[model samples]
Target chain A: MFWQVFLFRVALVAALVIPTPFFLTQAHADENLWGYVYGTDTLPAGANEIYLWTTSRNQKGKGNYRAWDTQLEFEHGFTDRFQASLYLNGRSHQISGGALAEDPDRRLHRGLEFDGFNVEFKYNVLSVYKDLFGLSLYIEPEYQRIDKISGERVNGFGLESKLILQKNFFDDQLALAYNLTLEPEWKKFQATGERERELELEHTVGVSYRFLPHWFAGVEGRYHAVYPEFKKRESDAYFLGPNIHYAAERWWFTFTFLPQVSGNPRIAGRNSNGRQLSENERYEYRFKIAFNF
Target chain B: MGLLSNFDQLTCALSLSSVRRIYQAGDLADDLVKCRLVVLRIKIGFPRQGVIMRTAQWIWLPAACLPVAAISIPAYAATYLTVEQAQQTIFPGEKLAPANIMLTNEQAREIERRSDANVRRKDIKLWKVANGGYFIVDEVVGKHEFITYAVGLNADGTVKQIEIMTYRESYGYEVRNADWRAQLAGKNAAAPLKLNKDIKNISGATLSCRHIADGVKRILATYEIALK
Candidate 1:
């Protein structure tokens, strides 16, 4: 009941904020790059945009394991060097087989549900056209509720930040971007009232080339590391992918497919009951479409 | 191996020939070289990818495939019009005397303050037609590129015609249409000349339309103070 009321309030806030007529303009070309590699380019001052995206992760193991997340984002550029965005996120999980098979109530249920809300701000420190490389700082704060397979709920509050750098060559035809991200999260279990903390560090490098007027092809490599208690290194993974982007005057779409090239052993340890704790996903795919008004 | 060498030599020769022509054009040599280099990199990069894919089997097949693709890749070309061509198109067969006007810092600032467009340069090219009219050339920034245009005015300081000489942006080419350019005709110094008011904007070409309209307003103001 509390979750329901919180979700209604978030939806109401989104409704009230979206209709404010502040500004409108066409989207930029570099804005269609991969999600992990934030572009150092900002829209012209007083420009507004809306972006919609879906991400699917396919885990390799057992029976039918996948996760899907969908998000809606509204962004506005208040000044040439400052921009802010709001996001509403939702997720779905497909869990079949494994230990959950023994429990009738937790056996096989796959459906989508509301997840959370996030607010982000980005400030450009240097412009690529004026400086050697573009540099920007970004921060996002998020609140989410996760529904587990055992009918338990976990609520989390998290903060993520990134330092983004980008450079363009050949009259903006070729672009290279790098991002270093850090996130700290705190979660509280509703059932047991237990709290946990986690820290994550991620680095991503991407390169894109505009082969045609509206088409761009690129590749990105990412390295992710996690610490459960902020002190001990728990796990790490590497992902590499190819991305393609297409943009018209007022709309754009981008798709990326990332396969985990390497990671810590999936079967890291076993519980006292001899059940193995496997690693995360094997591959992920993302699709994003955006419209400028 | 022989065929591969020949193909490389052929591309080099073709690139050099185009470079020679660019040099002959003279004014835009540096810009042309930069644009050509970008195109050449893409053309060369794609063929190498194909070669890497089929390296073990039939190496020559990939080299053979290069000519068809390389020949079709068009260079980034920007059209340039000499002053003679612009005058002939604006005021056909009539000789125009060069009356280049140099603006003082205060004059440039006044024009910039009054107009919606930003004046990038201090000197404005003005031509006095044989019939006491004026032909003016100015450049305005549209998005990231510069758009050069020619404007002709009658002796009474009213617009006669406007012609877009060079447009560098990939989109918004519709601003070059005769019907859109015709709307600026007969607009005098006193007119509002504002976008969406006196001039209607093209749906997809809003930036180009607004910048061009703002540019015309600035030029008209320049004519009143400097050329009149």
Candidate 2:
């Protein structure tokens, strides 16, 4: 009887608190300053926004390669520290001979294909405004039938979660953010009945300065490691670059040009200058635009 | 890796994160000690299953904090003061009576032309002092929020003091500094009231500074045309 009562109380509390953010009465913040890093800020309550992202991954240090990914995201703020989003994902890649067709290699994508979708939730425990430092927890669950790199039809499911931290200075003229992310995925091929489990750990940091009222400039760095089948570390990559952002009244756009600084490719000798190329691209340029309503 | 590990412990503390105890710049030194303690906690908690970094990071960590020693983050918000408090603070022993004024379109346009500031509203919120001075409440657009401030003028129509009643922008909180507001005191309609010229502009809060300066100028023009 005691255990049953405890479970009932827990379920009742969860039911009441889980739906509080969906009321959509007030909205707070709708601007993003970095391309790859996230800040621990949220909308007030009852606000809606749309975001469009275009990311270009180019150059593999060997053979001409290019990939463009697009995501149409709809975001809603339930409260000051809680928000949710839905995404429509699309991906296209072009590669001309870099030993991807070799044995034990993966399939490559050539044209535009619609990938699966992703649902994201974020909750802030602390904010930079009143707290010593800002901290937020973010989680996204993704399901994809097409491989992002190979574009082959496969059953892939991924769960990505991150801890975001932010700090501001100089009357919010200078802002810094950091994110630690872990993603675990499982994929199974329908044609060959092949199974794969992968784990990824990533750390990203961004420092931005509002040089002008409507303009912000920053630099971001990312270090990520991939573990195939959750065993040995397969590859590790480093990226660093500059980002620029412009915010209007209800719309804002941020762009970043990140180049792979160094990495361990561990691919069929397709590395460039000892940098990872086959598994990771030489550079990534991402542009994001958001509209608040 | 070490910094990320530090954040994990910090998250536990953030879970208790109702920041009801925050201080201004005067208490920044104590805050630095708190930050160092947090970093110390991170160092103490860095023994994981596989990661080993006890000596190598300790030797270089102090030098890494040199750049961070200069940073201080403060929150900006609305609701700095209220009208009754501002009235008492500006006009200590004297009583003030409501002397609100309404302006015609031509008069508003004329005030705008003379002061180079837009007259946002026709009806002005003001009060007349027993000593023949006045107090006015006005609002101006900031980058993202609206700023409401009160200006107290002298009997001769010059600015006596400027008080920021509420400032809700992401930047430009420095406009509330008494030293900066001192520049506006004793200035009449002959003053330029231009930001970065007669009035020093805050580095990040340019819009707030400019708008407040423009509002002051318009208020002076209003006194000359409507209240004088």
Candidate 3:
């Protein structure tokens, strides 16, 4: 089943990439301006960039769990309307002393592990510079290996897509952006020979004000929903935060912090008392630094 | 190997200021031929290797097209309108004399405080019409750039016409539209010329509209107190 899913994802990516090179014969240029929380714009044709980012998520639970994810990405613009990127991802975890900390089996070891890889493509359908609201489409495929602390392994594959929209007002001093994302994943447990499938939908909205020449400040809100077997709605979450961005001629940086306001954990029956409980995260923070060449 | 050696020499020659100066002086025909020969030699040296040759071709192709692209872009004249042209358009063939008005620091501050906009220049030019009116040229900040415009007021202090002299912003060129400028006509110092209230804003040119409106208000006040 995992092999079938992986093959299907690979085929889909191939279908999209096959016809791209035929139209990439010309080179053009455009601005690469962006907002902090949501991807609101595309790079110019023939532009190339490298990005490095890190995210930390803290969860308040039995053992005070914390997870860190890091990614390095190479992005290129094939034309004025299309962009492609590849990401190398990794993760690390740490647990503090608490209810589940005494059990070595329940606590995660503190170390970095190779997570997986993802390929992303984006196409701009409408441009704001041409007196219209901006619209873009995004598609991505991801593969991951769940590394074991002692000797447990799980693997997963996923496909995600998004519709992004943006608009500018007050002579480009203020910008508003929105994104809707859908993802489906298949996970296989090697030891149990069991497989599980899940679907997720997420919505994000952001507003930014260009306060200075190269500085922008904004706020973002996010809503996440999960479905088991693509049928029953199992859980949901909401997060809101502030973000800041700084852009220069050759490079840019952005930082954001989000705190989960409400949500229920999917595996509520696994709690100590076997009661349905909230699984909302305490906070999450991310920083990205990118360079254009 | 000989081609590789010539490629190195070609790069060194292109990097020299003397070669650039010679090109600027209109004597680069011979040097251009040498450069072309070096490029041809490099291409011929790797003809059998398709991948390497294609990579080299892509690198030089855009470089060769740069001059054409640069020359193809259209150039516009300077954006400013001279005092004579501005007076002629505002008064239509009427002889107008230029008078320089220097504002006191207190008066400049008073104008800024009343209009809620920055007053960058204290010295202003007022064109006195022989018949009866004042033509004033002023500038205001519009989204990191200055927008220069001319304001004409009748001797009775009512606005006659407003014409944009130079607009420096890439976007919000809609502020230069005549319909938008006509909104301020007939407004006087006693009338409120606030943006979004008295002067309807253009859809995508809000900042420019607001700044220009505020500037018109300030100019009206200046005329009322100093020149009227």
Candidate 1 stretches with Cα past 4 Å from truth are: A1-30, A99-108, A147-152, A268-279, B1-228
List, residue by residue over B26-55, the lDDT tens digit for candidate 2: 354446456444423223322331122211
Winner by TM-score between candidate 3 and candidate 1: 1
* B16-117 per-residue lDDT for model 1 (tens digits): 345546566766556754645543322331222223211111222222323332343233335556667888999998889998979988888878777644
- In model 2 chain B, the worst 10-residue window by lDDT is B50-59
lDDT of each: 0.67, 0.71, 0.62
Candidate number of the best DockQ: 3
List DockQ for all candidates.
0.02, 0.02, 0.03
Q: Record all residue pairs in model 2 with backbone atoms less than 3 Å apart, i.e. clashing.
A: A21-A78, A24-A46, A25-A46, A26-A45, A28-A44, B172-B205
Task: Considering the two chains of model 2, state its CAPRI-style docking category.
Answer: incorrect
**TM-scores vs. true structure, each candidate:** 0.55, 0.56, 0.52
TM-score (C-alpha, index-matched) for candidate 3: 0.52
Best by lDDT: 2
As a whole number from 0 to 100, the lDDT of residue B32 in candidate 1 is 56
